[model samples]
Target: MDEKRRVAAVWLPHWPVERLYRADRRTRGKVQAPKAPLALAAPGQGGVRVTACNRTAAAAGVAPGQLVPDAMTLCPGLELRAADFAADRAALKRLALWCGRYTPWTAVDPAGIGEEPDGLMLDISGCDHLFGGEAALVADLQKRLHGFGLTVRVAVASTPGAAWALARYGTAPAFILLPGDEAAALEKLPVAALRLDDATVDGLMRLGLKRAGDLYGKPRAPITARFGRHVAQRLDEALGFAREPISPLRPPAPFRARGIFAEGLTRTEDIEEAVRLLAGELCRLLAHERRGARRLELTLFRADGEVTRLFAGTAAPSHDALHLARLFREKLAQAGDDFDAGFGIEAAMLAALATDTLAPAQDRFDAEGADAEALAQIIDRLGARLGHERIVRLEPRASHIPERAVVSVSAVRGATPAMRGWRAQVEEQMAAALAGSLARPIRLLARPEPVEAVAEVPEGPPRIFRWRRVTHRVTRAEGPERIAPEWWRRGERRTRDYYRVEDAEGRRFWLYRDGLYLRDTEGPRWYLHGVFE
Candidate 1:
């Protein structure tokens, strides 16, 4: 049952007026949260209209949806601030991210079309115990937001709909509904508490259903015919009969370790120490699950609501705390001056984003294994400093063409199955080289350069060739090694005869004739393709 699911809704009543004047920019010396009577105004068919008002304006008989002239007459000293709907929405999202300090499962309440959002939702299912209990968690959350001069109301319950209704309509500022008590707790509230639109609420009120309890056990068919299924769906969701889950701003990482400090940490050294501790804790968590991490992320929450994140990846899955910590250290070092600890870092968390199953095994003591481990460490460090794409190794491809026989792949991915016989291939090439047989040149041209050649025979090696406006005579040459075109490819049906030739200056060139010898046809062309090392 979802009775175990605990969600909290936080409503910021004055957000529309406060967002404009809040001291939230990266730089200081800006406007502070409004304390005087203020109203947010927007352009309408009339001269102007008030969309929302602060507590002082509300107390002075100034309310929303009123013409500016009428509102000014009600509170002559009312201050008017242009409503910035876009900025308010963005600020609300930032506030939701700030709530990550309480729980990673935080999101801006999804507002319907034409509705302005001024609230946040948190799914703190298994997170309440960290702050003592459900009550204490709500209390702490409210206290911290109030510290930032925000006016908030909070409610905790088993469902998001229940919490949302209670936070906005319940009598108490901070309320908690015990599991399985949603119906009883919400019955006495107005029908609007079910989050119905004004037209629907008015229609229900006209039907003598002014309170949510009035809809209980009533015939659903008539209501469905009149109001469709939204009302019933919302009612079922709030009463815990149906599910309505909030989508968090960021999904919580499956494996994570968090650290909170009484006082903010300012020094880099202290943050590094905190990372070390978190790494050790994360490694233990992975070991318990018999998994290893391949990618990791570290998030630092600053006191000023600014968040900084650092990411690192490994060439191989690892549960070694020291090696993982070293990877983050390299990332931090690379960040250097870009890393800003504004005000101070109040909390930090390390999460394993990508993981793989790992089986325990004895450490290898052989030189080859040690060398491999060392190489992986180097790759990880370099990847952290530069980029993983920049750290690449050549992987063998299943192709006979010299140019198409290899591809570059990121080192972090290691090698592929096609590379299993790479060692044997290299050994065979070395044996040919030592036996005075010609092997492929180390440096191959992007495309063969056309050359003028004079061969001893029609299909034999070139006696001399002119390439790049330079002429060279062949001192010694090897016979033709015929290479045929791939049948699967659509190109000229011609075969190439490759030859290894050396000049008097000890410079070697690989030359090839384009076509086979024909009795009566256009003569074949010769090209210089490569230079030997």
Candidate 2:
């Protein structure tokens, strides 16, 4: 048993062509001689060129990168289709995501050339035991993918580079490279198996270094000097002398619980029941770890290979299983009628994507505490039903400008990070200022409206103003209150002079001048800012 990290590379040699067959089988329920010669063509320098070919086409000598006319000459029965690069990439992503049931760490191989992503990388380090052993895991993957009409070559190796190379270039359809045997096994493959681009591979082959073994004991200085560090780096990575990390489509959660049903579940009710049990198991894990889930995800893996994922989030960290289960209940209810069981669900996984420290609370309950919990449940339910982004609340920002003083954030996050850098100072300033002036108007316009005002003095309060094409006479007026611009932050903003006044109809208005008056200069423009009840 090798203690080093293990990676599984799954290469779909004809992904661009096979994906179309898979789609046909999925939508039309069966394939009509899908083994017939097929090739995908894309517009290249010289009109259309073949980008990918199925096994039958390859057998007929119609290989990729060949001109359409040449390939047609080689294989007259070839079914040609314009390459749907986008659909192929999306299907690859979906396939990679489906592999998560085997292990959480699965990513599309980053080494694919051009716009085509043809393989997946799986970090199956400690995950082999779940499926008996590494050999079983590889066999299971190949078998399942083959059942889906995909021709796959899978290899497990200690290093991702080695696994990727072996999967594509090794003699076997599915196999494993013992951890310490990478150097020996990799040497037999072509130098291109090391994931080098075309130019580097061509350059190395011209110098008679056509095999990985040719460079095994050769001087590194000359090879690196001619090809730069990339050649040396790829060699080191393939042999496990260098480190390479695969970025997973979704990072594995710290806390998780899995459930496998003996019989496939076809009804949504059964799925909900399974989710509840899984939630209970997950909450127990969180409690034992002294952590609580802030966001949770439920993944249902169907027997037919289609996966359904549902997500729920809470306003605060929670370990209560019932509350957590209710969150997903709302999601399932929201997905009513649109949810399909496909061929029935065979396994379910619940993971806490985000978590936080949660200390135990007192058993004694208080009215305020109960109300707070009730409110959190409401927020969670609403956020789950309506999108989390749609359920938001205004958070105060440390800004002097009224327009910039508040921002809308998802209510699922009860508070921002635990930093009080400028917020503490702002709170102190606000408390001190509250004792000096009356409260601000409850009704503030989104943006200040312009008004034509006449004042007795250049810096005094307005006597009357014309706003929104309506004229009003000022019956009660207050002195001007000046506000200076935040020059340190934004230098272009002007100083403002504000006043609180009431019209003859008892409607109170707050108005401000855009800039202070200078000697004989045109007075600053006046604008109505808010209204007071």
**Candidate 1 lDDT for residue 103:** 90
Instruction: Give TM-scores for every candidate, taking all chains together and pairing residue i with residue i.
Output: 0.90, 0.77
Q: Which stretches of candidate 2 lie over 4 Å from their true place?
A: 1-3, 33-35, 45-47, 110-115, 362-365, 390-409, 415-533
lDDT per residue (tens digit) for residues 1-533 in model 1: 29899999999888777665565433454456556788999988677999889888999899877999999999999998889888888989988988887898999984432568989999999999988998999998888777666789999999998899899998899999999999999898898888888889999999999998898899999999999999999899999889887889998889999988989998888898899999999999999999989899999988867688899988877888888888888888888998889788999999999998887767776788778778988999999999888999878876656667787789998656876768977997799789877778888898889999997777667878899998899998885677776788776467777889998889999988887667326678898889999
Instruction: Please tell me which predicted candidate would have the highest TM-score against the true structure.
Output: 1
Q: What are the lDDT scores of the predictions, listed in order?
A: 0.86, 0.85
Looking at model 2, the pairs that clash are none
